[model samples]
Every structure is written in structure tokens, then in C-alpha cells.
Target: MLDVLVVGGGYVGLSAAVAIMQAAPHLAIEVIEAAPEEAWKKDPRASAIIAAATKMLDVFGLWDRIEPDAQPITRMIVTDSKTSDPVRPVFLTFDGAVEDGRPFAHMIPNVSMVAALRDACAERGITIHHGLRATGFRDTGPSAELTLSDGRVMASRLVVACDGVRSKLRDLAGIKTVTWQYGQSGIVTTVEHERPHEGVAEEHFLPAGPFAILPLKGNRSSLVWTERTEDADRLVASDDLLFEAELERRFGHKLGTIRATPDRRAFPLGLTLARAFIAPRLALAGDAAHGIHPISGQGLNLGFKDVAALAETVVEADRLGLDIGSVNVLERYQIWRRFDTFRMGVTTDVLNRLFSNDVTPIRVLRDFGLGVVDRIPGLKNYFIREAAGSSGQNRPRLLGGQSI
Candidate 1:
């Protein structure tokens, strides 16, 4: 029997397996992925990885491989305006560096991150099985048995589900979630601009939703443009000329003329919070545990936080000669992560509702609040540290760049 069996071999799953195996090499850990081996290479999405998550990657010895491809967010600016507005006045601005002089976050391509994690797993002798789907799950007293699409049953002392928001393993394990759609779909794409961004990230809160321009390496930027679901589909299917025209109307000429890459896609936005993070020998991490809006760009960071806490919990339990899969042992991880996850979920939900509209009174109130936060240096610094994931107390060892 394997000591740890992780489903969904994405960044989160691979990181979970690698973290445990690196700390407790005596334990057998493996990953099961539903996608083909090369499928991860085709993903064009990029995520904002906070400083705390970089610390974890540094602990895994993979930061050096990823940092070269990442673009640090040296500054962030927030604005509120209409889609037709000629000018977007900035309401809040945050300098990206924390007290230690490290930038709060970096925009990294998803493929780069997964490539580094997979390489780490390979070096650590962790096997990853691809092109297999998990069909069922059963938890006996001693171990959890996972049923695969290939008519195979694998038993492990513990099972970790790092699958996405729509996790099959989460359903098979009888876990329920609080889920709701925002009727919004975020259109994500890569655009090449005429001028350098200078590592500045901007979030323009329009009536439809927040339009974000996150800087990438070189003269490129990644855009997350949120619109109502129906309009989003229309915009994505429109001709390139019309699409570029509409994009320019909202994107402005600050970065000069922009041309989007052909690999653009739209993802529906929603909030999903698992009622429970653990059940018997199974623990859900990443999107399997919770999925939130991208307003704050902390979705993936939350998953990394889960990986840190879960890994530490299991490793320390094994060192103590305890059942690593026991509810008691897993409960510690749940307690450590549950409140934080729920709080973030609520915060994103509220922000999406509050800003994704054109109410007159609300516009005044929220913009005023943003101005207040911007003028107060102490408050702005506090928020920047919070976004960097460095302000919390009693964080996991890995997040602090320490070994378990």
C-alpha cells in the first residue's frame, strides 16, 4: 500500500505529493492524473503567485528554475470606471514590495510552474500515473481504496484530492460544498503591447466586472476581462477585428496598440467552498476544497497554503508514529486551513458583488473606501503584506521557507 495517493496531477496535486515525499522519504507517495502526459504543456494560463508561495517553492528547491520565467509585480493600481469612460482614475495604489523588500507577487505561466514541480517529483523518485481517471473510492478501517478507470484498485494510508473545482473524487468521497455562480465569465488571454509595463499591474473595475492587466515577461501582458456570461461568449466568438476593437476600447492606449494571442479562452466564475476539508482517510486540497473569484488573485495561493499545511500535518504525524490518515491527524490540517479558506471565499464573493455593478451610491462608497486605504500608508502596507501572505501568525513551516 502506498503511504500517500494523490489524485489530479496538476500543480497542486504534484506539489502535495512532492512535499510529503521530500519530508518523509520513507513514505511511498504517487500521483494519478486524468489528463495525458503532455496536456499540461498546452495550458496558456498564468497565475499570480504570492511571496509566501515562492518561499514554499524555494523550500522545494524549484524556485531557481521558475523565477527566470516570472515577472514580479513591482506595483499595483486599482481604478473604477465605466466601459465607455475615456479616463480611469486610480483610487488605490500599492507598492508591491513587502517589508523585507521582496515583491508581494509574481505572474507566472501555469506551464512553467507545473514543469518545475514535475521535475521535482521526478528527482524525488515519486511516480506519476497519467491518462487514468478515478472512478470510485472506498475507505476501509485501515486504508483508502481508490478505483481507477483502468480496472485497478490502489490502496493508500491516505488519499489527497487536488483535482479542480469540479472534482469527481470529492463527490465520490461524499463531501458537499456551498457553490454558486456569478453569471460572469472571465475572458483570459495574452496580449503583446507596444511599450513596456514596468512591472505594473492594474485592475479596472468597470460596470460589467473587473478588467485586470497583469504584466508578463518582455512586452507581454495577461488580461482577465470579466463580462456577463452571454456577452463573454459572443466576444470570444467574434472576429479578430471586432474583438481587438472592443478590447482596445476597454484596454486603452497606455501600453500603446495591443494584439491578443490566438490562444484566448473564457472561464466561468463562481464560488465553491467544501463544507468539510477531510473525510475519513481523504483530504481535499486546492480547488477541490474551495474555489473563489479572481478579484484578489489568491485562488492558487490558497491551494499552495493547503499543500503546506497538509504536508506538515502528515509528516509530523508520521514522525510521531501515529496513523497519518487518522481523522485526528488530518483534523489539524483542516483546522489550520478551514477558517482562512472560508474567509477568503466570503471576501471575494462580497467584492465581486460590490464592484461588478453600476450603482451610484455603492460606487461612491467603495471608491471612497479605496481612496482612504490609499492615503493611509500604514493601512496600505498592511494590505500589501496580507496580499503577500506574510502577515499571518503561526503559518506552516514550508511557507516560511523551512523544512518540515
Candidate 2:
């Protein structure tokens, strides 16, 4: 029987496989993905991997492969209202860096990270089954039996679901989720500009929502512009003239002519936090466990955090000769991550509700709070570090530059 069977091949599932192998080299691991391998061929909407996450990836031996294509964020320009207001106002701006020159984060394309993960997992002899969607799952005392969409069965000591927000395995295992739609849709697209962004990531918080412009390599920037779902769909389907014109207004003239790249997409925003992270011999990681607004760009990192913690917990349990799939073992994983996940979830939720509005008195107070946080150097570093995944209980392998 296999030691662990991960039901998904996205960032979360692959990361878990890698981390487990590093944490306990003898543990047999496999990943089953529903979609065909690398079939989703498009420029990904991008994910902001914080410094600590980058460290974990470095441990997985992926940093070098992905570095050349990434853009380090050296500065963050956060404005309260308008992107076009030059001298009109400046609520708060964060010059990004750790210590002296170490970058706090890197803007990496989603597809590139997945490619790195897939290749690395393959190199480590992990069985990544693409085109095999999970239909359901059942815990058979000592092991879990996974049922795939194509009438196949895989029995393992532990079953992990990283199959996204609408996870079938999570549902099959009877795990409940607390979820709600944000009404706003994040319209993600890349843009090319005439001038270099100088590694500056800018976020302009409007009444509609935030228009975030994060720098990619060279003259490219990734946009996560929030709008109503209906509006976002129209924008996504609109002509170049209509889309670019609206983009220009919201994007402003900071980086010169901002032409949207061909890869245009929109996803409705929502918050999905699983009620119970584990059940019997089953565990949920990534979107299957919890999902939050992308305003903080913590979605991927949060999933990585779950992967790192759970892998370490399982490995330690194995060393103790305990059943890694036991409810007690899974509960330990839940305990370690629950608070951190809840804390970050609440922060993002409140921030989204606070900024995704135009309440006059509240806006002034929020802007004031922003400037206050920006001015305090020590506090700013703390918040920055927290956002970077350095604030929680991380694994030794993740921290000590070991492969995981």
C-alpha cells in the first residue's frame, strides 16, 4: 500500500508531495490530477510569492529555475483613491525590502510555478496522474480508498485533497465549508509598457475596488483589477478599444501607454474556508481547505503553508510509529494551521470589505490607518514579515534550506 496519495496536481498538491519526500525520504508518495498535464496553456494571472515561501521553494530546488522569469518587488506604491492623482494625494506608500536589500516578494507567473512543480515532482519519482478526476473517497480504517472519475481505485494510508475550491474528495469525505461570494470579480491580465516599472508594485484602492499593478520581468505588469462580476465579464469580452480605455483610466499614466496583453481572464471573487480541515484518514490542503480574497496575494502562499505544515506533521508522526492517517494525527495538522489560516483570512476579509467601498468617514479612517502603519518602521517590518509567511510555525526543512 502507498503511504500517501495526493488528489490534485496544482501548486498545493505537488508542494505537499515534495515536502513529504524531503521530510521523510522513505515515504511513498503519488499525485493524481484531474486535468490533462499542462493542458491549461496560457499566461497565468500571477501569484505574489512572499520571501518565506520563496525560501521553501528554494528548499525544493525551484528558485533558480524560476528566478530569471520573475520580478522582485522593491517598492509598493499604495494610494488611497486615485491612480492619476499626482500631487493631489498620497495616503501611504511602502518601500519594499527585507533588512537592507533582500526582496520581500517575487511576482511569478502561475503557469511557470506549476511547470517547475510538475518537473520537480517527476524528478523525485512521484506519480503525477493527470486526466484523473476524483469522484469520491472513503476511509478504510487504516487507509483511505480513493475513487477516480474513470473507474479506478487507489488505496493509501493517507488521502490529501488539493483539488481546488470545489473539491470532490473534500465533499466525498463529508468535510463542510464556510463560503461566500465577494460580488467583486478579479479581472486578471498582463500589460506591456514603454518604460520599466523599476520593480514597483502599485495598488490603487478605489470605491469600486483595488486596481493592483504588480511588476513582472522587464516592461510587463500583471493586473488584478476588481470590479462587479457583471462588469468584469463585459470587460473581459469587450473590444480592445473599450477595455484599454477603461484600463488606461484606472491604470493611469504612471507607466506610460498600458496596452493589455492578449491573455485576458476574469474570476469571481469569493471566500471559502473549510469547517473541518480533516476527517478520519482524509486531509484537505490548498483551496480545498481554505480560500480567501486575492487582495493580499496570500492564496498560493497560504496553500503552501498548509502543504509544509501537514507534510512535516505526517513525517514526524511516522517517525514516532504512529498512524499518519489517524484522526489524531490529522487533528495535529489542523491545530497547527487553523489559527494562522483564520487570522490571515480575517485580515483579508476585513480589508476587502473596508477598501471595497466608499463610505466617507470610514475611508478617511482607513487611509489614516494605512499611513500610520507605513510610518512605523518596526511595525511595518512585522506586518511585512507576517505577509511573507515568516510569522507562523514552519517546518525545519522549509526553514533550513533542505529539499522539500
Candidate 3:
């Protein structure tokens, strides 16, 4: 029997496996991925990794490998306007530096981050089985048994599900969730610009939704353009010329001529929060636990936070000779993360509802709120630290750059 069995071999699952194995090598850990091998290479997405997550990666010895491909967000600008408006007046500006002159976040290609994580798993001798899915999950007091698509059953003292929001394992384990669709989809794509962005990230709140332009390496930027689901699909399926024209309407000429790459895709936005984070020998992580909007860019960071908290809980329990998967042991992780996850989910949902509209009174209220926050140095600093993931109390060891 393995010590830990991870379902869904994405970044979160792989990170969970690596975190535990590195701290407690005597424990056996393995990952099962539904996708075929090398499928992760085709992903054209990028994520904003906060400073705390980078510290955790640094502890894993993968940050040095990932940093070269990352573009630091030296500053962030927030604006509110309509798509037809010729100008978008900036409402809030944030200097990205947090503590010790470290930028609050960096825009990193998904490929680069996952590549380094996979390399770390290889060095740690962690076996990752691809092209396999978990069909069923059973907890038999002593261990959890997961049935794979090939009819093979694997038993482990603990089972961690890092599957996405629509996790089969979560259903099989009988975990319920609070979920609601926003009727919006985020259109993601990469764009090459004529002028440099100078490491500035911008979020423009238009009538449809918030459109973000995140700086990337060289003269490129990654865009997260949110719109109604139907409209997003139409835009994605539109011709290059038409799409670029529409993109330009929102993107403006700040970065000069912009050409979007062809690999654009749209993802439906929603909030999914598992009511329970653990059940017997099974624990949920990543999207299995919570999936929030991209308005704050904290989706992946929340998953990384889970990795850190879950790893510490399991490692410490093992060091004390306790059953790592017992409800008592896993409950620590739940207590540590559940409230924070709920708070963020509510925050994003409220923000999305508050800004994704054209109500004049509401717009005036929100913009005034933003302006107030911007003018207060102490409040702005507090928010920056919060976004950087370094302001919370009782943070996990890895997030603090310490070994478990």
C-alpha cells in the first residue's frame, strides 16, 4: 500500500505529492493523471504567482528554474470604463513590492511552472502514472482504495484529490459543495505588443466584466478578458481580424500594436467550495476544495496554500507516529484553510457582481471606494501584503520558506 495516493496529476496534485515525499521520504507517494503524457505542454496559459507561493516553490528548489521565464509585476493599475469609451481613467494603482523589495507577484507561464515541478518529482523518485482516471473511491477504515479506469485498485493510507472543480473523486467520496455559475466566461490568450509593458499589470473593469492585461517576458502579455458566456464564445470563434479589433477596443494603444496568438480559449467562471475538506482517509486539495473567479488571480495561489497546509499537517502527524489520514489529523488542514477559502470566494463573487454591470450609482460607489483605498497608504500597504499572501497568521512553514 502506498502512503499517499494523489488523483489528478496537475500542478496541485504533483505539488502535494512532492511536498509530502520530500519531508517524509520513507512514505510512499504516487500520482495518477487522467490526461495523456505531455498534455501539459500544450497549455498556453499563465498564472500570477504570489510571493508566498514563490517562497514555497523556492523551498522545493524549483523557483530558480522557474524565475527565468517569469515576469515580475512591479506595479498594478486598476481602471473602470466602458468598451466604447476612448479613455479608461485609472482608479487605483498599486506598487507591487511587499517585504524586502520582493514584488508581490509574478506572471509565470503554466508550462514553465509545471515543467519544474515535474523535474522535482522525478528527482524525488515519485511515480506519476498518466492516462489513468479514478473511477471510484472507497474508505475501509484502515485505508482508502481508489479504483482506476483500467480496473486496478490501489490502496493508500491517505488519498488526496487535486482533481478540478468537477471532481469525480469528490463525488465518489460523498463530499458536497456550494456552487454557482456567474454566466460569464474568461477569454484567455497571449498577445505580442509593439511596446514594452514595463512589468505593469492592468485590470480594466468594463461593463461586461474585468479585463486584465498581465505582463510577460519580452514584449508579450497574457489577457484574461471576461464577458458573458455567449459573447465570449462568439468572440473566440470570430475571425482573427474581428477578434483583434474587438480586443483592441478594450486593450487600447498603451502597448502600441497588439497581435493576439491563435491559441485563445474560454473558461466558464464560477465559485465551488467543498462543504467538507476531508472524509475518513480522503482529503481534498486545489480545485476540489475551492474554485474562485479570476478577478483576483488567487485561484492557483489558493491551491498552493492547500499544498503547504496539507503537507505540514501530514508530515507532522507522521513524525509523531499518528495516522496521517485520520479525521483528527486531516481536520487540522480543514480548519486552517476552510474559512480563508470561503472568505475569498465571497469576496470574488461580490466583486464580480459589483463591477460586472453598468449601474451608474453602483459604478460611482465602487470607483469612489477604489479611489479611497488608493489614497490611503496604510490601507494600500495592507491590501498589497494580503494579496502577496504574507499577511495571514499561522501560515504554513513552506510559505515562510521553511522546510516541513
Q: Which ten residues in a row have the lowest lDDT in candidate 3?
A: 81-90
Q: What TM-score do all the candidates reach, one by one?
A: 0.99, 0.96, 0.99
Worst 10 residues of 2 by lDDT: 395-404
Pairs that collide, model 1: none
lDDT of 3 by residue, 126-209 (tens): 999999989989988999999999999999999999999999999999999999999999999999999999999999999999
- Candidate 3: TM-score? 0.99
**What lDDT, from 0 to 1, does candidate 1 have?**
0.95
- lDDT for each residue of candidate 1 in 23-83, tens digit (9 for 90 to 100): 9999999999999999999999899999999999999999999999999999999999998
Q: What would the per-residue lDDT of candidate 2 be over residues 212-317, giving only the tens digit for each residue?
A: 9999998999999999899999999999999999898888776887789877989888999899999988899998988899888888888888887788889889
User: What ranges in model 3 sit over 4 Å off?
Assistant: none
Go through the candidates in order and give the C-alpha RMSD of each one to the true structure: 0.7, 1.8, 0.6
